[model samples]
Target: MFAARRFVLAARSAASIGSKRAVHKGIEGTPPMRYMSVAERIAVYGLITVSFLSYPTYLMINLDNIRPKGENSLGDNALAEKERRAAVRA
Candidate 1:
């Protein structure tokens, strides 16, 4: 009896799966920007502008902190040391 009930449920699920239909259809119309008010549009644009500008502004303001400390790959420190030694010797 249990096996028969399980087989019936399996058959029903398989049949229902083949008959599935879409619940929500895609909307076709003008862009959502057309519905926004003037203030909302301005606010959205301002937020976008601030988001783009903030990173460069932050980088410029914290350049000293962001930059690597000490000698770079060019061996500027070694050259400076050599110049100092030469000056001292002279």
Candidate 2:
């Protein structure tokens, strides 16, 4: 009985899948960017530029915070310290 019910459900799902249709046919061809006003275009381009540049700008601004702990910009003092500790241990 369960197997028959499962078969009925599966058949209904297959029929529903085949009956599916595209509800909205979206705009074809070129995007709507050409229709934008000059100010709108400038604002859109400015936002895009800012978004693209934000990460690099943030990295530059907070370089010390972003770097891994114990790492120095001048050199790898962490490695030297590890070596010194190892020598002391030995």
Candidate 3:
């Protein structure tokens, strides 16, 4: 009971304080809701693409450690096979 009341009070205080700050002048006295430039959008998309592309690279690196020596691929490898089984649902 006490914890719930305290949480409510804190949330109210935070909302009120945030609204007060929202009125303050942002960078160059401009609000942040403004749209980004075309160049900025392109850079942001490029960053996102790079970030996603690296994900497969990291997974490949970990899986590439033992491709020879008659060992199985990452899915069939003993270690990763256990993990794969755990992740898969019947």
Candidate 4:
């Protein structure tokens, strides 16, 4: 469900790289404008879907259940260690 929201928001957004770009050619030997086909669009979409699904797993592996572990046990405690470090640096 969360991923559905994320995908819709991302896919529908104008800022997405997959979205069409209206690049115009200049007269100084610039190449002609190129159009993307449905197959190309589908390939880009497939890439986005794979990336979105795999991102959480990558995070879990690196972030240890999406939270710090061992020497940095902030967890639900939230930024307590950060404040302590700032206090020390001050």
Largest lDDT belongs to which candidate? 1
lDDT of each: 0.85, 0.83, 0.81, 0.71
Q: Runs in model 1 with CA error above 4 Å?
A: 1-27, 71-90
Candidate with maximal TM-score: 1
Model 4 per-residue lDDT tens digits across residues 1-90: 999999888877756554334343346445332456778878888999999989777876888566756674567556887788889999
Worst 10 residues of 4 by lDDT: 17-26
Q: Which segments of candidate 2 are over 4 A away from where they belong?
A: 1-27, 69-90
Model 3 steric clash pairs: none
> Which digits, one per residue and each the tens of the lDDT, describe model 3 over residues 1-89?
99999999999999999998888757766743357888888888899999999989887888857465575455548768788788895
- Pairs of residues clashing in candidate 4: none
Q: Which stretches of candidate 3 lie over 4 Å from their true place?
A: 1-25, 28-35, 66-90
RMSD of each: 8.5, 12.1, 16.6, 23.7
Model 4 alpha-carbon drift over 4 Å, by segment:
1-34, 60-90
TM-score-superior candidate, 1 or 4 = 1
Residues 2-90 of candidate 1 have per-residue lDDT tens digits of 99999999999988876553333235445778889999999999999999999999999999999889855657798899999999999
* TM-score to true structure, per model: 0.46, 0.43, 0.34, 0.28
Evaluated against the true structure, the overall lDDT of model 3 is 0.81
Q: After superposition, how far is residue 39 of candidate 4 from its true place, in Å?
A: 0.8
